[model samples]
Target: MTVDYSLPKPELGAPVRVSPFIRFCRWGLLFAGIAYGMKRQRTLEQRETAHRANLRAQKVIWDEEQKKIATQRTREQLLQLAKDVNVPIPADFDTQYPPA
Candidate 1:
């Protein structure tokens, strides 16, 4: 017998039907996921900006402290040198000689 290729084959199972409500729910879920991802990204960027600002402030404070310490040490060294050489320390010593 010759096989006929013109007729449409019968479906093995029931045709799948997607309801309107299910389609709407799927779209809603997709939108919600996109919104949540955008919000999360913005939050992370804000946190990074705040962290950088805090680091810069800390660095400024540290630099000021270092300068103060260096100046105090220089003053102490100058006093010791003057005492060793038997020379009187000048009244405007800090202005007369700056730290190297």
Candidate 2:
């Protein structure tokens, strides 16, 4: 029988054979990932800040609406009082509540 002539393959690639361009691309991707994460964090912080500001604005608006409703209720009660006493109610009766 004729002897086999194929050579045995090596277990691993040669050392220091990694291309410099591929290495640079790997490092560039790593830095890009870090920058992207920081940008996402900043965006989240901005959104939270805006949400807090909106909530504060809404609270102010709610307080003003409540004040108006309370004033109207107070005026209605004073008008009822005047009716019970058979007297004319003052136009500025709303300014007086829990009269002292």
Candidate 3:
């Protein structure tokens, strides 16, 4: 048996004008970028949901405080009205009167 290793080989046509392998790599990179963008959008949505919940809780607390202040103001005004009319003021007028 004889081995044909005597002659050396030449380059094949200036190494293919444009490589298909490079194009496939570029497409893979593009797909990865798209996936990252989608994940970021979902993260933003979760943050917004949490922020909205916090805002709602704060609003409820503020509303309760405002109601207390309004009740106090009404009680003071009624006491003044009673004094002006020479009427005896009740001790528990706030508890008895309905807030408008």
Q: Residue 78: error of model 2 in Å?
A: 15
List candidate 2 segments past 4 Å from native.
1-17, 63-100
User: What TM-score, over all chains together, does every model reach?
Assistant: 0.47, 0.44, 0.51
C-alpha RMSD by candidate, in order:
9.9, 11.3, 15.5
Residue 74 lDDT (model 1): 81
Candidate 1 clashing pairs?
none
Better of 1 and 2 by TM-score: 1
Q: Residue 69, candidate 2: how far off, in angstroms?
A: 6.7
The C-alpha lDDT values of all candidates are 0.90, 0.86, 0.86
- Model 3, span 1-100: residue lDDT tens: 9988777777577555667889899999999999999999999999999999999999999999998898878877888899999999777775676555
Sorted by TM-score (best first), the order is: 3, 1, 2
Q: Is candidate 1 or candidate 3 better by lDDT?
A: 1
Alpha carbon deviation, residue 50, candidate 3 (Å)? 0.9
Per-residue CA lDDT of model 2 for 1-100, tens digit only, reads 9999999986985777679999999999999999999999999999999999999999999999898788778767777888999998766664565343
Considering every candidate listed, which one attains the maximal lDDT?
1
Q: Between candidates 1 and 3, which one is better according to TM-score?
A: 3
Which scores higher on lDDT, 2 or 3?
3
In terms of lDDT, model 3 sits at: 0.86
For candidate 3, give the lDDT of residue 36.
93
Q: Which candidate is the best by TM-score?
A: 3
